[model samples]
Target: MNENLTNAQNIANIVAQEVELMSALVQLLKKEEEVLVDNTPDKLETIVLEKNTLLTQIIALEKNRNSSLSQSGLSPDAEGMNLLFSQLSTSSDVQNNWERLLNLSSAAKENNRTNGILINRHMVRNQTTLNILQQNDQTASVYGADGQSRVNSNSGRGIIAG
Candidate 1:
């Protein structure tokens, strides 16, 4: 009925949708973890693509929510959101939804971090295997500004003579 109420509802809906997306992201991350544990790198590409798409959707929805908040003369920050909620008649429900959304976001972030660690571990293992196969045992090598290999001081002796 009231424009402010309508704006508040829109914001709520956006947040709820974001929470849904984040939930999906968490699921995807869990699936990725399973795939990683199984050493199924092939499945990861598809999962990554799905994650990127969900991320894009979440970003777009956030932009829309910000626009809605701005239109309602809100700052689009935490304080502004609190102020907006205080002004809304549905404050209690909206606040609850916001809290849930925040929790979901935090959980998603943690899951994503775990997935990243898993990925890094997989990469390191693969690199180590490759190095062994190549018979190159160097502490580590760095890429130079020109994208050339910069040998580490500890490169005591490469399996292959340079």
Candidate 2:
């Protein structure tokens, strides 16, 4: 029983860490959305690096949790978690932590999906702009009524130009 309690505490600690990391990830996703909306590329690399670090931390915590579960003769799956929760007498705290982790994970997934959609929309819009610019022939420059060279209204390409 003491061993189960110790394992449960370890599992709970891991879950708490996972929850924190997921929450950080969600925050980073929100920051990414801001960066996307504001069209700030300079700040994006930092956000990406921070998010990667958080992911690495989360993965390591999950590995530790899985090891704890395996030591308890659990299969390190959802079923294993459930079994461990049932076997641990002081499992209420662990269960609560696990639930919080799950909620944060779900939120992170949804926010990430939203960011992906934003990126795709941006890509399509940029692609359309590029297509317009590329289709315009440089030799076909038109002269304005004042005899000055008329600028191509659709010409737009930048660092992300592809």
Candidate 3:
């Protein structure tokens, strides 16, 4: 029973850290959305770096929590978490923290999805602009590779005074 309590405490601590990191991730995602909307590439780059770091930390905490669960002969899934909570004396606090972590994780996922849509929209707009520029270049060029003037027979403009 003592061992079980220790394992439960360890798992709870890991979950608390995960929740904290996940909350930071949610806030970062909000900043990312703002940066995307404002079209600030510089700020976006920095935010991406920060997000990566936070995600790394969160992932590590998750792994630690799962490992602790496994060591306790648990399955490291919702079922295992439920079993652990049910046996714990402080189940309410631990269960509430786990729920909060899940909610924050969901928020981060949605924000990331929104940012992906914004990035895709920007990519399409950029590609369209590039295509227009390429088409104009092909039609507007008056000189050939040998530095000779090339005339377009389909232009319908003829020399009047030459």
Candidate 4:
């Protein structure tokens, strides 16, 4: 029973850490959205790096928590968490932390989706601008390969050669 209690406590601590990291991740996602909207590429790059590092830490914690759960003969899912909570003398803290983690995860997911939409919009706009520039370049045709001014017949303007 002591071993079970110890395992429960360890899981609780891991969950708490996960909750904290997830909260940070959620905040970072919010910052990412702002950076995207403001069109700050440099700040967005830094934020992406930070977000990746934070996500790595969260994944490590989750792996550790899952390993602990497995060693305690529990599945690494909600059922397993509930089982661990059942074994604990005071489960409220861990339970509450788990709930908070879930909420933060949902927020992060939504923010990421929004950022994706923003990125797609930017890409489409840039592509449209590039296409317009390319079309104009083809139609204008101001210079020839021999460095001579090439008059575009379609433009209805020719050199006076005065």
Rank by TM-score (best first)? 3, 4, 2, 1
Task: After superposing candidate 1 on the true structure, give the runs of residues whose Cα lies further than 4 Å from its correct spot.
Answer: 137-162
What candidate 2 gets wrong by more than 4 Å, as runs, is 136-162
Give the CA lDDT, 0 to 100, for residue 6 in model 3.
Answer: 82
Per-residue lDDT tens digits of candidate 3, residues 6-29?
889999999889888998889989
- Report the poorest 10 consecutive residues by lDDT, candidate 3: 141-150
In order, the Cα lDDT scores of the candidates are: 0.82, 0.83, 0.85, 0.86
Off by over 4 Å in 4: 136-162
- Per-candidate Cα RMSD to the true structure, in Å, reads 8.1, 9.0, 6.6, 5.7
Compose the digit string of candidate 2's lDDT tens values, residues 105-126: 8888988898899889889988
Better of 1 and 3 by TM-score: 3
Q: How many pairs in model 1 have backbone atoms within 3 A of each other, for residues 3 or more apart or on separate chains, i.e. clashes?
A: 0
Compared with the true structure, the alpha-carbon lDDT of candidate 2 equals: 0.83
Shift of residue 86 alpha carbon in model 3, Å: 0.7
Tens-place lDDT digits, model 1, residues 65-98? 8888988889877777898888887588778877
Who is ahead in TM-score, 2 or 4? 4
Candidate with best lDDT: 4
lDDT of 4 by residue, 13-73 (tens): 9999999999999999999888889988688878989999999999999999998899898
